[model samples]
Target: MYQYKNNILSIPARLLYQDWSLMSYDTYKKKCDRKQLIRTQQGKGLGNEAFLSYADLPHEIKSVCLDKIGRPEETVVINLLEPFIIPDSKASAFFSNHRTPEGRPLAEPKQRQKSINCWILNAVQLVFEDRGMTGKMFGKRKTRIWQNISEAVNKLDTNKWNHTLPGAAKRLKEKYENYLKEGYGIFIHKGEGNQNTAKIRGEVADFILSHYALPIKLTIPMVLAKYNLRRLEQNWPELAESGLYHWLYEPEQERIWTLARHGKQAWQNKFQHTLSRDKSNWFPNVYWAIDGTKLDWIHFDHTTGHKMASKLRINVLFDVYSEKIIGWSLSETEDHTDHFKAIKMAVKQAECRPYLLTYDNQSGHKMTRMQEFYNDLVALKGGCHHAHRAGAKNNPAEQLFNRFQQQVITKFWFSDGQGIRVKKEDHQPNTDFITAHKHHLKSKEELSPAWEMAVNQWNSGKHPHFEESRDEMYQHPMSLREQLSLQEIMQHLWVTESQKPITYKKEGLTLWLSHTQYQYEVYDGDGNIDIEFRRKYVGKKFIVRYDPDAMDVYIQLCELNAHQEKVFVAFAEPKRKHIDIPVLMQADDKMSWARDYAVRDIEYKRDKTAFEALIARSGYSPSAFIESQELNIKFKGSMPKKQQQKVDAEEDEVLLRM
Candidate 1:
């Protein structure tokens, strides 16, 4: 027996082997060789030649080798190579002599034989029995009972057993091959290990793809939920609280509301109501309403840098119903002359004589000269009725003034010289003034001039309001006058005059006479007719009337026809009252002696019988009930009859003589 320590073997069998010197020496030599082979096998250098040499060694050497190598290959090699020559006793001796240090016999050949027996047994068990001992049990039983167990142990090991002991080794080899083929049977295990990780990774990928990989068609709520969840997950509480979440929900509507609240209110108060034609109520040639307004007044001189100093007033007249401007004047001063010019323009522009001219109680409109003109017009039956009324309620023209101020005048600031108050002595240009002009030009001259130009351009140019020029709005004066025929224009020139009743005192015959200073004398059959006439006032009225043609007065009834024939008879004045005759006449025909003639007459006669009767009745003599008459009969030509006819010879001679 031997106990191995480190790389050396120790033996207690020296006394038992004292008489076997040669065997002991051979055993020592074989043991040294086996130790060499064991060293070689353990170091990964073993080969078939080393196994054969180990099996052929002597019993004593094999024992020594077994003790030295701690493995039994030499004895098996001896049994295989020299089986016929070696007796069973020597082989048995060889196997018994070999023992491990534990006192068990080192039976290298018998161990090999026993391992073969066990392998054979396991094979028989697998072949004959319903269930065989498992390959693991076979490996354990072979390792416990086998001698020189390297080959038998290798046959039972699945990897080494594949080469020997065909049936059991092949089955064991197949089992291990299938285990490797199924990836170490680890499919379900790997899946179980990674399941939670894959799920979390998939969710993260879905979030990233949803945000960045697709078009943004989601509603605001969806977007909010997505971002909120993400932010919550990301621990960004502050980001989640930003009102940007709500703002993105209604972006367009909120933007529009913001603009409406903050934008300019420039065009809010434009004119709302338009004048309707039905509201106009025009009287028939009676009322003449006149008014004027100042359009834009600037403190600065609009023409030159010279301060206009005074505001320019533009006077305009509205014909109320016509809505036409009858007169207009642009002037710096708001004096009576301005008023007079406006009125004169209106009068000349009126299509018919106005009955009453209504005007506001302006001081400039109440001039004495204007009043005198009104009285003269009344005297001429021109229907001069002047009414000075308050401007508050009755003035439609004042509304127009307000419109002008609101719409046009107040839109611009005037550069009128009223800038900064300075002493008159400092008014002259100096270095400071020059500096002001250079530096403060925007305040000084820019806006006023631009405003003036804009207004002028608006008036003269096409207007958006009327869609016409200011000049075109009221017809051009020349064109309007030219549109009327010559006769119609001449008719417009006729002046009206009224007649008062008058009585004459000559010869105690109460007569109505017209007084006249002599301008022309007509020769009647009784020589030059006197053209002088005297007027006498008989009650509240003139007692005489004048002859328009003879330029003298006769009894009111002693006027005549074209042939020196009497036309009217002198009448006696009534004791109770003197009667007055109503006269409406034109002054144009009496213009030659207009200043000298006290009255003018006009007659509309359509027939010769009326003319002849007036001529014959004019020759009556005056009595106390009537009156004496100094009559002058000078005939003015008569209007041509529309239908001329020739009478018979007798009638023709009477007409010619008459």
Candidate 2:
């Protein structure tokens, strides 16, 4: 009693092997053909041996097989006769009648599937249709669709089709939405009303639809809608209180929040330590670097005169170790004397002798007096040397000046607190108003000193790199303490040597000293000398031991004749101070500063013959002689206006000449 169920064929009962007997006969015949057998045997055998018919084989293989065999029809027949034996039933089922319980037919058996380009086109058409669009619409209206398809095909060829498909779909959607949005022209408009209060929300839905590539959860319309709802409730309160909207719009607020969060994190990570201790060798000796900078005086008392408007030069010396200002001096002039005074003050204040004192190669530094001072210290064995060749980068002292200008000077405004009372402007009609406000603005005074004090306070308060205040760090006790007084220490640190004179030979009346020749003669009672008796390079000035009773001016000269020439000898004027020439010469040996090293006998008061002999032997140019005199005087105190003007003019002339 077999019952049929809706024309369904049951597996096994329906006899899927109906053609088995015929297939076996055909397989037996095929097995006899060697060509067909070899063809079936090719490739790795998974299990089943399903043969490809010669007629069904690709054209490429058929052509190659025919060429190899040398006869097209025979080769085809031989290849067709080859039989491929099926494996065990279970293995055969893999390529044959494998089916599930649903009893649907398995895939087409052992026949290579033909590639259908039309079928691919159909699948593409179906895809477009599913999106409520057509291929024509995609290609004609949106050119990117065709581009995307080409790109997808390239991806498919490269085996990267899996990733490209989804991305391409997303990009296409975004492009289409953007096109429509731009067509409608929806944008955020700013400053539309009085105090920017009028708000118009128009075509927002269309905008969202056009810009649909944006994440639905992050859509601008959704955000704005919520914002507007909130604004409605707060509008009255905002208008009543201070009349300003405090809430910042989207992107700007987000940026500010992000920066603040990151900034706080960075600040928390910062740490401080003692820079001096971190690098011990950085400050081994007390190297005080000295320099001066001019700071402008903005507020000047007009009554002090226009000269008061001149800038002040502030000299400062910094101890390189503690970064403390060891010395400071303020002067109205930028001269060598002012610089020396500053240096003296700084030395007196520090009390600790700096092993090295460095300053720029300014005229003041190269002056004879200053150089003499350095030489004197060197003579005393001080390890002192001028940092003559330091460039801006090598000198940290100059950096401090830069810091002062940048940090302090540039930040303040100057003002004088003094008030003034003056007559008001006379007006024939508005007398009452004019009389009511009769006071005048007061004159201004310099506020730089106060500003400087403020800077000192600031520097002492906290250091940028160091954990402690500058004062605290400087005052902190250390293992090493300086043992020598500042001056003595400077002397100990310097290298010194005696200068040897360059001499020249002359026959007649002059003796050569330092390349210059001077006539040697004993002054008569009237401080006069016989020009004919003058001794030249005679070594005649040598002291001779004589009996005290027989002491007399010894004259040694080659006298060819008794005729005498009266030499007008200039004696030290009784009222004038007598400068011991020898003492002055010895003073040159230990110069406190090079500025005071005098070149002797520049302007001779003796006879022209003596002067000419001195000039010729010394090789002293008149210009150099004049320069030496001009350089020797130390100008101190404030000069009168006329004198200062003259000095300034002279300085300009000198600079121009240079």
Candidate 3:
């Protein structure tokens, strides 16, 4: 069989590999006068059997994924139906043929490889059937498995399979034969040369492994020393000097692994054991991941006054669906207040409440106040979930914080290296010689731009294989308006709640908090805070909400389940004003004198006279009216020169008449 007009294989790739699982095949065929045959022969003629390990495949093939050690947990041989391209051949110039609709040619072999990877999948319709010893030598489910293949072959669509049968067969035969010679494209036996001469017996291999592996890991040298001391393994060469180094490092490392505890000491010492579980949710505002990480660079915490002995912690509330940093807070402590503030910002900015929130079992996340905050705002339609404390595996927020540190935090002028920041090395700040540089440390308030930059960069980065940025994904096209309105969210979910006792004062109700008097105007004129609400909730509680900054305090009488508990009657700051002393100067001095006299005369008479009657008819003496006269004189003195002179003349005339 022979065909060669151009360098193109001109044959269906599948037909060549149809007998791949046969284990052995003998073929003698001629194509272009090149004979590539693999015949099974053992015993005297062949000293060793030519066997290809099913697991290992070259990197050029994407159908198989395996570790560098040439082992796959299970064989993953996807049956591909595509034209085979041998790049070194002349027909390989067809590269530019694969173009986007925009008329852009694909990038070299990688693009072609991706096309193959995308189209090929595990064989679905193909299943091998073996007939028992009774059936004809080797009976299999050939008919069912190759219906499509047979149909395609008979139809012989040149568009689909552009290659001739003999050409495809030659292509497969050549590749297969070359692979066998190359040890199935994987390095099997070594370059050890004479290095592997120090023979290790099976029993000694067991002893070495047993000695090397312990609950607390020992260095290779220490392990080797322990192994030699046992005297069970004799004639053992030093590990480094021994050619078994490669074996000990990787492939046969299991010999050492059996006796060693894998992460045994750390596993024992760890406080929390994490188990993985699926945390996937498809809807927007359905899953919120919250976690906090310490920023590498220091910031001055005025509360403690040391240049941030505890560095600033960046708390993030990440939307898992969009991979967006929806909300964040930079705080001195991983306080529940900061946690609430972060979530409050997210809820208000996102305008939707999360049905489920995931957090780690950190002290901040575990606070009773934090739990209450979630209860009051989160609705718990889907309950709260917590990950194990130490590992960030379950918390996507932690992952985002890692990204934040790398992209945003480490870029700062004062960046101490974010230790866990991946892919950015050699940027870690050295503290040993740089202690005096603490003066260059920025204050907590100064890093406002850094936080903004973190969010901007985080949401602006283009997602892999997608046209949209993280911010675009966050503005989810599929999001539906939630049942809860902004009003409801602001009332319950948007604000932090505090419970405090209201003292009933004759002036007004004063609720003491944080050493500041946050006075509130009673919503109902009936004095609910002092009497009605107080009587019902005295020694009980009421919900108080403040802004994210905690600058404004708002007390509310909320009963969400009862009638309109979702609604809140807000108590705002009492609007205060100074009395208009200028306006009071316009009043008559005679009226002021009469009122002062009536107050004393009325007190002596013990009469329930109306203030209107006293102003019209009361008579008085100088002693009772002295205070009012003095106040009149002071009021007149504050007026403008011309006005004050006129008022003085009138006051003097009034005093003379009296």
lDDT of 3 by residue, 1-658 (tens): 1111111112111222343321222221231114232212211354542222222222332132222223333323222222322232212334335433224565665444433222221111111122342122112344332443333222333443343222233333343344346421111123332344245445455444443444345566665565555444356543432433434543234322422345433222221111111122323437889888786766666777554443677788888887888888886677666787788778878776676788887776765556666776654455455555565476677776766676767776667776635444566666653466777666778777767876788789875447998888877664434455788766564443444334322223355533455554342454222233322232223354555454454455432443434455445444221222343332553443343334323322221132222222322223323543576677755768797656544442343345
420-442: candidate 2 lDDT, tens digit per residue: 23243220123343234323312
| TM-score: the better of candidates 1 and 2 | 2
- The number of the candidate with the highest TM-score is 3
**Model 1, which residues run further than 4 Å from truth?**
1-287, 292-296, 299-308, 375-384, 411-658
Q: State the lDDT of candidate 1 residue by residue for 1-658, as single tens digits.
A: 3332111232333322353353464564466466632321121255421122333334665675455556632222211111111122433344356433223563464444433323333343342233232322222354332222223334233432222332444443453344346521211222222222222223332232232212233443454455454545555432221233222222222222222222212101110111112112233424456665443434445467654343556666655443455665566556545555655566566543455566677665655544544443321354565555554677766765554444455444432221235455322224354445543334223444654454454345443357666546545442212132345433332211123333222212232212312221112233211112211111112323232222232223243344644344333222111112123223532342332222111111211232233233422111210111111112122223321122211221232244
TM-score of 3: 0.37
lDDT of 1 at 183: 28
Error of 2 at 246 (Å): 97
lDDT of each: 0.36, 0.38, 0.46
Task: Give the C-alpha miss distance for residue 236 in model 2, angstroms.
Answer: 99
What TM-score against the true fold does each predicted structure earn?
0.22, 0.27, 0.37
lDDT score of model 2?
Answer: 0.38
